[model samples]
Target: MKISLKKTDLFVGIYLLSAVMFFIISIPSWLLDFLLAFNLSVALIVLFNALFAKEVLDMASYPTILLFTTIFRIGLNVSSTKLILRDGDAGKVVLTFGQFVGGGNLVIGIIIFIIIIIIQFIVINKGSERVAEVTARFTLDAMAGKQMAIDSDLNTGAITDKEAAEKRKKLQQENAFFGSMDGATKYVKGDATAGLIITGINLVGGIVMGMLYSGLTVNEALNKYTILTIGDGLSSQIPSLLISLATGILVTKASSDGELGDEIVGQLFSIDKVLMMVGAALVVMGLFTPLPNYIYIPLGIALIVVGRRLKKRTGVEAIEEEVEESEAEAQEIRKPENVVNLLNVDPIELEFGYGIIPLADVNQGGDLLDRVVMIRRQVALELGAVVPIIRLRDNIQLNPNQYIIKIKGIQVSDGEILFDHYMAMNPGYVEEEITGIPTFEPSFHLPAIWITESQRERAESLGYTVVDPPSIIATHLTEIIRQHISELLTRQDVSNLINNIKDNNQALIDELVPKLLGIGEIQKVLQNLLSEGISIRDLVTIFETLADHASVTRDTDILTEYVRQSLKRAISGKYFPSNETTSVVTLDPNIEQEIMSSVKNTEQGSYLSLDPERTKKIMASTGSELKKLEDMGKNPIVITSPIVRLYFKKLAVDYYKDIIVISYNEVESNVELQSVGMVTA
Candidate 1:
């Protein structure tokens, strides 16, 4: 049989042995030497680990290790105290520490011991405790915001579910680790306090034992026992000080890719100019002031040499990197695969000029990526579809402040933004004018001015809507997405929607998809719905309606009208309050009869073949009625017969793109309708 032991078993055995050592009345000299050496080794190991660990969680067992090591130190203190009181000498470790560390003076030894205690108790331990407390509080406070960011990323498809779960787990562990460190600092404080008390007892008890039992004179007792007590105090307090320093380093360290030493070297000396300037200043001071030439002159010369070397090395590295990149690009251009790769294009792309780069760079405090993630989530909820990831890059050919938004390789919208200025838009009622650079708001084309950041408060007080540059871009992107969503829905997007519902509605999918309509046909219907800003979130009702109507007619437009009638309540609620009366424009009786007669049906599709003059007259009348509704601050909706609704919409789309045209069959009977005006020809 083989006997096996795990790390946990070894740790438990060590802890039990330490606990047993505390109760032993006396430890042999060899054992005393071993314990002292072991204590010093543990303290050094902890100190180095704290300094070199790349991540705080890498030392997740630090608090537990701190507790056990503290106990082991205390146990060693007890055993040493016993040896010193029983015999005139403890062990060679104690005696050697007394003479060498104290320089053969009891007062010097005591003062040194007290200084260590003060430094540990007042400075290192206290600072570590406070840092751990603040870190724990801040981590807990920001937990909600961090979790929201993770959720937004997940919903936007920026991260997979497993990656999100891992991030959340790490967040939880950070909170727990900081909380534990806060409590662990208390142990260090107690250990320091115990060291002070134990040192005092050893001094007094040793003196008493030397006079009463060991038959030594007063002078002899004072000399002998005071050195022994100070020695014992120094031995224990040195390790205590090391451990306290380690705790301070651990608590104060920030998140970084490398160890503390590497971070300090990289960041502190990254700038050669700063070193050169300091070196020059030091040389000047040494020559003018009373400072010794041996001190400042040598140091200044060394610094100057190092600065020049660093500058030279950095320049060489940059040139080498550029050369390598150029060669790689040249090679890539010759490859056949490179030409093939150019055939693919992003569904949506955002290109900005040089000055706008900071708005998307993470290191410059830009949150455009985060804003884009949030936009995707918002679009999903409102439009009932997941948007593809938007590719962003810089284009040098454009003006520095200009940005262009493109959909499927076609430019949809372009705008310019001032990076350091706030845009204040007139809300149509401000009496006083503010002086600034005049511009128009990109999203709605309203009159706006780019003002300094300091003017934000005054602009808000004047009832103007103030927006930042990133917000301007985000708003423009939102509007462009809403306008061009029809072009963005692809066959793959439709397939993703199907896969999402296949588990619960597999039978419905199998019956409707491919049997009644293929994916491409379904995609077209969805595009039609999205083009008019209709949500396809209710896909179950849509597919069922299609199943009922597909057998009767294979025409997508005719089938779409049937689907719209089935979604009458949703359509009505979008335009008006639920169960509330809506005011709308209606065509004149004669005009409706003429439009009905001119409709031409063919094998391909249906279209209006009205004379050009008659078409112009109908459009002119509709425009006039729309203007009247706008003057009353009302959005006008045109209600027409179901047969002419699509044809009328096709005619009005060019000039009245903002107006909504719905069929009578698409309005629910529960909704009350009032006629606001009439369109006559």
Candidate 2:
């Protein structure tokens, strides 16, 4: 491949090289004159570019520019000092400043040069250094918070992953720019100081050389050398000072909008009242004080006229804006409704009323958005499922304290919260209660009380589980997501999971997905596992199991059983407490036999086709046995034979959805289970 450079690149390349050459090789006065002019032009370009750039990132390479300009400026200073001592004339540019700007006065030119140094070094350069240092520190410190905000926006579907990536890139550029600027200010300060030193050296060298070689008297040599030195200093410092000013402006600029001029004008002078008052003050000063009335009086009167006219125009603009808004509203009402927008639905939505708004508003110290992000992460860890973006919105139709959680546009559950209070629930052991508004916990419908901040400490002391409003909403949202995570796992989500697996285990994914089972089939199997509160995180095992058994059976229910049995260790760890005996109920042989006999295997799938009356008896007996386990402070786990486990779970789902049915094949042998009771019909 061949490479080519643009004209701008070549120009910049040559210019920087010339700056270095100027420091080594003596050039003719004309060439020096042209280079000095070129330097001034470049400085002006940089100053304007820094001034008008809408964002600092627009000038992301500014620090490098600063280094280049400083090197070039120092080269000019050195070359001119040599010319002043040897030939007594640097160039026409330096001479023009000496004669014209100083009005033929050596003292005036020297004083002016010193003043420039003071302003640039003590004021502009110093302020820029401080501003850049602080900006860099603050920018770096804020990066973590900005990154999390981007992630939360991405998870909430407020921004796409691509947009988030762009934002992160911009943030990194800003950090780099500010960090480099913090150091770049040093170069400007050093350049100004070096110029001052060079000017002084030139003054001394020129006077001594002129007196000895040119046959000039002491005063003549002093006047001649001092004028040229001041001229050279002025020519160099002017451009250097402009650069310093640009640096200060760029660092202090916070707007990513228009130029500095526009922001200053619009912010300070746009207000009619401020303009009018200033006009009044100027007019009063002109009349009452000894200041020149001719200068102040006309300016004040013109300002007063401008302010009154601006006020009238502003009023007209406001009326025009109202007219435009009314016209827009009328046109909107006349237009046909947008059916496309109405057809789309967010995957998850948490709409609350006005009073509950603060609980979701991040600016008001609410962390509901952060909690929502954590809920997504928690679901991924717990069930190996990606919860869809949860949307937060406010609805005026709801009662002030009410909020509803919707899945696919339909409200599944709702809860009311007193915004300024905490919900305290007894954890079954606390006999003491604090006084508060009585309520029920929305997630579990357990009895709770809404207590004020004053009572929160007392309630916690009494052993009540106290939760704030945001936590309450987050908890309820999490529970709802977990309960419906199975249905939420679409084919796209399954494909995403497969893609994630392909990153490391391509062979397993390639062989298992679409070869033995389609995405829908895989989805159904995963859903089946999720529906039973089993995690599918170990997709390698799940996919490997499917690859082994899917060729024999495509039925999701039967495949699910194979998966569950394959994941017995995980299942055992989940349901059976660690290193402890678990008291559970076992299904009677008659009931297991009946469940298996009633299972109907069709081309679609397998399900229990038990008689309705017999089903009622089975469900009643199952619930009663599970209730006994519950009363014994144990989870409602049922142990059944391998073949009847799936069918028995199906039979019990109509009445006892919370029942945890496991097969003898699905429990690890190390797990100890005590059969406290048996379910018989």
Candidate 3:
């Protein structure tokens, strides 16, 4: 049998096992010296690793390393203390360190040992402990916000699921790593205190042993034991100091893109002007003050030379970079595939100017992006439309406060707003007046006043509808979306909606989709409903109704009418108030007959074919009735016979693009309708 042990595993096992072995069994001085040297090398390696790592999590097991190394160092201290007390010699490593550092002087070695203890214990270890504590606390607190940012990016398609998963994993590891470090810092603190206590014990116990067993004089024993204790102290404390310094550096290091040395040099000397100013100041100090002219003048001149060279190098690099960038851009534009990328346009875009950027920027406490997200949800719920991702960007050409909304890359509407002002509009009942800047509400084109924050309370108290800039923008955006939603509905959108239904109600989709009507036809029917601001959330009912009627007539217009009649409840709820009589206009019977008679049937579908003179008279009468309804403060609704409803709607769309033309069958029995006027030709 062959044992195949990995080097890392075997090394770690021996290391940990040796820590225990030092406590259990006695080791010779040669092995102790070798272990002491190995310990120093490991400590140096840890310090270098911590210094160069770009991210703290790159050494996620640092806390565990601290634990294992502290234990091993303590074991070495115990073994060395035993050797000094029992045998008057620890090792050549400890003896040489004490003699070389002390220069064969007793007091200097002790003083040096104490100074090391003070610096490590008071400065590095204590500061590292606090930093680790704060870092762990902050990491735990920020986890939620970071996770939300990841989710927001995922929703916006800014990052993939894989990237998000990796971010989440890194976040979790950061949390655990810092938490472990918070506790691990305590080990280093205790190790320092333990080293101090064990050094005292070795000094006192060595003096007693030397006097009684070696028959040395009190002075000889004191000098001999003191030197050995200081040696042992220096040997152990030096490594401990290095370990604490590593901990301090690791915890205090801010995240950077490169090694510690490189980042430090790049940032400290990046500004040539600062360097030149410092060099000039040093020269002045060297000449005018008591500071050494030999050292300062040469160093100052060297810095000045380096500054000039760096400045020239930086200027050359900037010019070269600019030239490279322009050439690369020209090459990119000439590429056929890259040119094609420029032609693609966003479906919906909200582009503003520089002045409005703060309102759209989340870091500046702007909720416009959040409000936009909510608008998508609101539209989906109310109109059953999957709104495309809305693109937001700043335009330099427009006025500072002006914003433009674009649909399929065409500018449709725009509005200007004041940042810190409120828009106050009287909802028809406010008798009180307030001093404010006069404006018009962009959404409804109603007269409004831009009032200061101070006047917002009084405006609301006076029964005026007070809104902020963000609400004004959101409302305008919602209205624009509602008006163009029909055109925005695409075949892909219809397919997604169909697939939603197919998830649970596959039978209805399979029957109505391709068997009776294709996706394009279904899209038209849905668009017809959306065009009139009808909710299509009830896809099951709509698809079932389509299946029942699609077999009879494949014409989308007639099929839309059938679907509308099937959704009478929703239609009535949307257009007419429940348990209330709504005043509307009724199409005259003569005009309804004329509309049906002139309907022209083609292979594709049926359309109204009334002559110009007759069509003019019909539109005039329809406009007159709509005027009467508007004057009476009623919605401009026209009720017609089910057969003529579709034709009349198509004919009047040119004149009243937002006209509500419904058939008698499209009204539920619960809806109370009062005919206040008539449309006659």
Candidate 4:
């Protein structure tokens, strides 16, 4: 969720108050101080526990940790710097502030903090691996399969106008409530106000408790005002606003759910009045707090107020009421419960969890046994549990992208085991057992090719197993990889990869230049395929996998040539046909005079012959010109017509012999027309 100004203001307010409370409490003596520290430690323990239990770690606390360290060091500097006035103590050695805290020190601290923040960011950005696992484990009522109902508008039914209105109201409510939770969690987690509250409560409470415990009168405890003031003064220096903001920012950004509440608090409490009140309180308490116990009571109360204020301001209760109304409306829309019987769909409940496969001796033969053993060992070592291997098969064709293999196993762990040797066993086993396996079944026969040590190792390390015997699995694997590689190796993007190789090795030009020159046909095929709506990303992925596999040890030039030839063949066969019928123009002289009359132009004294059918068309067209003249003259002035006159004056007067225009094709060029024209009366 994007943070709104309202949220930011609330955060600022809560932070200010929390900061004051926290700082003030730190100055006072308190019984809960140790408990609070323990709680913080327990929280850390929980977070670390999650790291192992979760597929993805929640990294939000890391930044807070660094920020806390920095602020904590700065806030308590005065108390730390004060030297003890012990009897016979050596004279104090005066030192410059730079010696204790200089520009270099600040720079170093910032860099450390930045590094911690970045590490946490990377850790958190990886999507919740734990969500899937936790959902499976904790959400026992919910099944682990995706909802696959196909929604048709008519059958699914649309929401009623009433429901829609209710939904709007509910959404507004949840947004507000969730926002309130956001600010409250931040204040409670780690801010100076929390500390100040602890300090004030602890101070007053401690004085009371100490008086009770030591049998000192209340007046005696009151006499230690100077000491209390000193402690409060030290506490006041701790910036409650800065600490709260830092913590809130960390929690907001780090939580799996976006920190809506943090933003809300930051916005609400950021006003000058709130800051002034909180700041003044922190400064006063920190300087005056003698006993720590009194600080916490006030700090806790302040937090309760901060939280309550945000909740009230945001109107979360109203929102919840509104949401309840909406949900009720939605319930009315859903059809009354109906028992729909399903056939041939006995679903098995599968529990899924991340298994960390420890590396065995990679030098072991990259075989099925070795791979399975490696996976088993790794799982055991990581979880401090032994897992039973359900079954193992070899030569299975899995996804080309990841050497995915289905391993049916259960984790049983309460002890530590070694994993280093497990990884080492995969490559060695691949060479011995996996490569030369023979055909397993009638339907699953396949081919075997040279497998790179790295490829074998990668396959084994990932616990990939062939589901079928060697021969049968080989064919399936080949077909799968072939389909993917064929699509990928023939793409336009491949040209970019080619360019990179070409710059370093001009030999590529000699290798693939012919293929490059003749890529137009292949490009045409790809376009046709694209037009047919084949997925481009799928094509790219297949090619990228092929390229990655090739990177294992294949000759770059040879692979390039191979891809080019394959593409050339696919293009030639798929789109362009070599033996296609050539279109030709043909003319029948028998209907020439009749056809010529249609054009309204036919005046011919002689005809010419030309090679091929094309020349015949030209000659036939000329004869039509004479017919055109005959048609145009209503009086039938056959001798006086311009076309007839031109033909007779130009051809009949001069060279009575016929001329034939013969060109490339074997069509006769007016030869038959000339023969007829010369014999004409």
Q: What do the candidate models score in CA lDDT, each in turn?
A: 0.86, 0.89, 0.89, 0.33
TM-scores, each model vs. reference? 0.64, 0.90, 0.67, 0.22
Clashing pairs in 1: none
Give the residue spans of candidate 3 off by over 4 A.
1-31, 79-89, 133-183, 205-228, 270-293, 308-337, 353-355, 361-367, 373-388, 396-402, 407-421, 433-440, 444-457, 478-681
- Candidate 2, pairs of clashing residues: none
- lDDT for 594 (candidate 1): 86
**Candidate 2 lDDT, tens digit per residue, 106-197?**
77877777888999999999999999999999999999899889877876578987898999999999998999999999999999889988
Q: What is residue 360's positional error in candidate 4, in angstroms?
A: 27
Ranking by TM-score: 2, 3, 1, 4
- Report the error of model 2 at residue 586, Å: 3.0
The total of clashing pairs for model 3 equals 0
Indicate which candidate wins on TM-score: 2
Where is model 2 poorest over a 10-residue stretch in terms of lDDT?
A: 255-264
Q: Can you give the lDDT of residue 22 in candidate 3?
A: 93
Per-residue lDDT of model 1, residues 1-681, tens digit only: 999999989987976687576667677767887788878888999999999988888888889889988888898889888888888777888877777787988778777878888899999999999999999999999998798777656644568779989999999999899999989999999999998899889888998999999999889998998888887888888988999999999888898888899999999898889888888888887888999977898788788888999999999999999999999999888766756758877778889999999998766988887888778878899888888777777899989999999898888889999989999988888877788899999888888999998999998898888999999998899888888888899999999998888898988898888898999878888888888888888888888888888888877888788888888888988986776677889978788788878988898877878999988999999999998778867777899988778778888888788888899999877888888889998
lDDT of 2 at 566: 96
2 or 4: which has the higher lDDT? 2
